[model samples]
Target: MSFEELPHQADVRVRVRAEDCNVLFAEAARAMFSIMYVTCDEGEIERRVSVTSDDMQSLLIDFLSELLFVSEVDRVVFSSFDVVITGTSLTATARGEPFNPAKHLGGMEVKGVSYSGLTITRDGEGFCSEILFDV
Candidate 1:
């Protein structure tokens, strides 16, 4: 799995590619969190999250949005994700510790995930999606 940041006029945009949908979702999580804050490899804390949407695009947005809410409320940033997608429902295990100002600071402040320019497609290289995070 891999992700890269794309230049944008405002906000942050990323394109994540993975071997499958499950991994794609997980990478998306990593991409979003990485953009928001710098975190260590020590994912000592774990959190389980579940979300459902009517479609794939909405599912991705909702999943990240929920994670963003949790991060803000609990003062944490997840470093890794194990995600499973069954139709429109998603269940994930997010692993990371509480926010450490020294480690988790100095990154973009993501306001929210945006649907604009959001696209998911499958090719021989597996699955890929471009997500826009509202900053």
Candidate 2:
């Protein structure tokens, strides 16, 4: 697996390309958000993940979904990304935070990152489980 950080307008863009799907998934998951058990090809296939209107959950979900959507829609697997977290919030084109895809293309379908096991610790970092569509 290989990873690189590409330049972007706003938000974080991670590009990852791995020979092993599992390892690729792990790296991508780690980059997108902190996670415990990276989903496997045999586990309960996750196709979508949602976030609450409040808190970091929204930003997290939006960020991961865009990756997956990009992978599905575009033929590119992101090996790295450029992340920009400002004032604990962001702005995007559509609903939720906006990200400029033209700047960073992490080609990978990431259905959604869930809030089920999400734990925003006091230190301001935590873990969560995300659902990937076809990965």
Highest lDDT against the true fold, candidate:
1
RMSD of each: 1.2, 14.4
lDDT of each: 0.89, 0.39
Give the top-scoring candidate (TM-score).
1
TM-score of 1: 0.95
User: Per-residue lDDT tens digits of candidate 2, residues 47-115?
Assistant: 232323355545555555665565345433333333333433433221112223553334343345554
- For model 1, name the residue pairs that clash: none
88-125 per-residue lDDT for model 1 (tens digits): 99999999888888877788888989999999999587
Off by over 4 Å in 2: 1-53, 90-110, 122-135
